[model samples]
Target: MNSSFSIGIPSGRNSSACGYCSPPGERSQGESSYQVAGFDAVQLTCQTYQGMIDRGWRRSGTWCYKPDLRASCCPQYTIRLDALQFKPSKSQRKVLNRWNRYVLEGEPDDAAASSQKSRSGKSSTEFVLPIAVHASEISNLSDESPTHRFEVTLEPSTFTEEKFTLYKKYQSTIHNDHKNSSAGFKRFLVESPLKDEPIPYPQTPPPYLPRQYGSYHQLYRIDGKLMAMAVLDILPTCVSSVYFMYDIDWEDHSLGKLSAMREVSLAREIHEAGVDNMLYLYMGFYIHSCPKMKYKGDYSPSFLADPETYEWFPLESCRPSLDTFRYACFSHPSHSSDEVITDEPDYLQVPLSSDDEKEIRMLVASGKRNFVVSLSESPYWQYDEIQRECLPCIHGLGIDLSKGVIFKI
Candidate 1:
């Protein structure tokens, strides 16, 4: 079972909506509480909570504290997947077979998911997960392979020096870019003041998973080796996957999918056995601009958490409006619940630099209000590659390259 929950992203709509900002917040009548029913039909919205945090709003686990809006409840749910109905692609099967041979038979695994027939036309010893790490999140599940019994256990990470070493190894394996310094990573782990000693990394774990709520961390190991680990923030009704990483060496094993699948299984098992309202997997956003990211929406039957009405609508039903401001409202559970799928000007057109003014004039003279650049003023331009790639997309989201401005047109 996996589902989504809404995190209210406030729209600068009615002024009284701002009244929810008062300290020790108050909730007005007629304002609906953002609640949903059953794990099967869960949906949620995104809130500008990060921005709100700066304005003195506090965080209680994953739920943000609104001084005045006491009526708001952190909505969450779990959705049942007909896992047996899933079908893995040809590439997926190759990955699975390779891992099966390697892990069970000690044979060489195929490095690639695509089957072009090995040079010898015989299976080799090298094996890897058939899927790419960047593949769609929805593709993680597969009913194509026969199900096998696996063990499940819950234990806190030992936080030993050895585990810490493994953690570093995992980080090094994935950080091909080497963007962070050893010091910077260390500083990030310890943001609060400690007395005589510092909080241990890979031992105590961080307070919250980057995007989830609640304070819990656990390590999952298979056989005798540590293969996968998750640092999640468990909320009242959902579990948000904060940071999930698996050994790249176990790529053929589909450990990333296994981690998520296991989590879902655990949630189902837990719910069946006793836990209350534990539905939905907040796997984070599914950005279509990032192809590797769109898979999150494939886990049917799903609906985007509308930002307006706090309701859930079928994803297939909203295909027509995905590119418009209407999509924002329709995709949001909040707006959907209230049946408020309307839009206002979300962006403003500003002038570009003098150097670019001539180009702007030419575009304007041709009655082309749609220029591809300088939507905003930034010292250095960003998203150039994104613009180039998106330009060819038939449903491409317009790229305002001039001022680095992008409005959902």
Candidate 2:
């Protein structure tokens, strides 16, 4: 109630140029990305944000939004991987082992890595994922050393000249956005409002291991040269991946997919360390219609959040429905037809101390929370129309987060 927990202002439904299959400088009818009510948050606790995500919300820096699956050309369904159940594919293991070998032995062992395919191929046969994932990092190494020092640093999100340079180069090389400015980079990656809360590790983890639940920039450096970075949210229940970028020179290594694997390991380490609730790796949106985005389902035993019910369904079980339509409802596959849902007003006063609440109300009736727009207030809603819009965010985020968040205009 006192601004220490969570504070979010609703941002109404909006549209953007679709990321997949939408060619530049071209406008096709009914081809655009849409998001339901979003929250431009000032701050949020790890637990509250975790709940927000489970209900289908995802955040970029400080802006949290849920996709409108029914109308968007590529309906984005929230997906997650169960870290405890994840089994690395042969190719995936090769990537990790190859990277680890290069760091520990200072050479790419592509052939050797491919040959040793038994049970993680590490020093232990038990196949400990947490250990295998960090084997290449300096923290886990012994006196026996390699030529290159592979260092992975976990620190709170902030701006720096080196990180900015890497960002600029990645943008220009991969995205062809040579003019990406530092301010824009900061807004998209560096700026975050998640407060750091210590991970509930049964025993305090090593210094190199992250000890907090908050937004972080996980930097990957080889021999002191910054090569890659993964923007992450270390929350109470999952390691929510925000974004990942690597130097174009290292694209062959598949750092993007490798980063996802490492994130799962991070969650596993926390879970194996005794945090029972920490079992998932929250991969952002799963757009099944897009080829580039569909690989997220490869992380088997994964689940997709039903847009209407907020229930989790196995990705494989939902694939049939997804293949049949752009917006598929796995919970009720018989009703696969796309349909927009209307949600009621999602506004409530944050409970406050009786005296404080009275004083604040007297000074400003809308004090500290007045901007959240209710869907019912829209003139179009009165006329009973639901075209080209996704499900209202109130339904996606549900009433708990709706009332808990302070409405921002």
On lDDT, the candidate that comes out on top is 2
Residue-wise lDDT of candidate 1 within 1-409, one digit each (tens)? 1122221212112212221212212221334232110111011222222222212232322323322111132112112222222334454445545544443345544455324445556445443222322122222334433232222334332244434544566777875534544444333321111111121123333222222233334554445566666654344344445456666676657666555554444443333333445454555443332335456555554455443333555656654455332123453424323122123222212323456432211111125553333313321223443222222211111122211212122
lDDT of each: 0.35, 0.73
**Model 2's TM-score against the true structure:** 0.83
Residue 168 Cα positional deviation in candidate 1, in Å, after optimal superposition = 3.0
For candidate 1, give the lDDT of residue 95.
Answer: 50
TM-score per candidate, in order? 0.42, 0.83
Query: Can you write out model 2's per-residue Cα lDDT over 360-398, one digit (the tens) per residue?
Result: 111112655533334343223222223112124444455
The Cα error of candidate 2 at residue 303, in Å, is 0.8
* lDDT value, candidate 2, whole model: 0.73
The reply for model 2, stretches above 4 Å from the true place, is 22-30, 108-126, 338-395
Model 2 per-residue lDDT at 54: 85
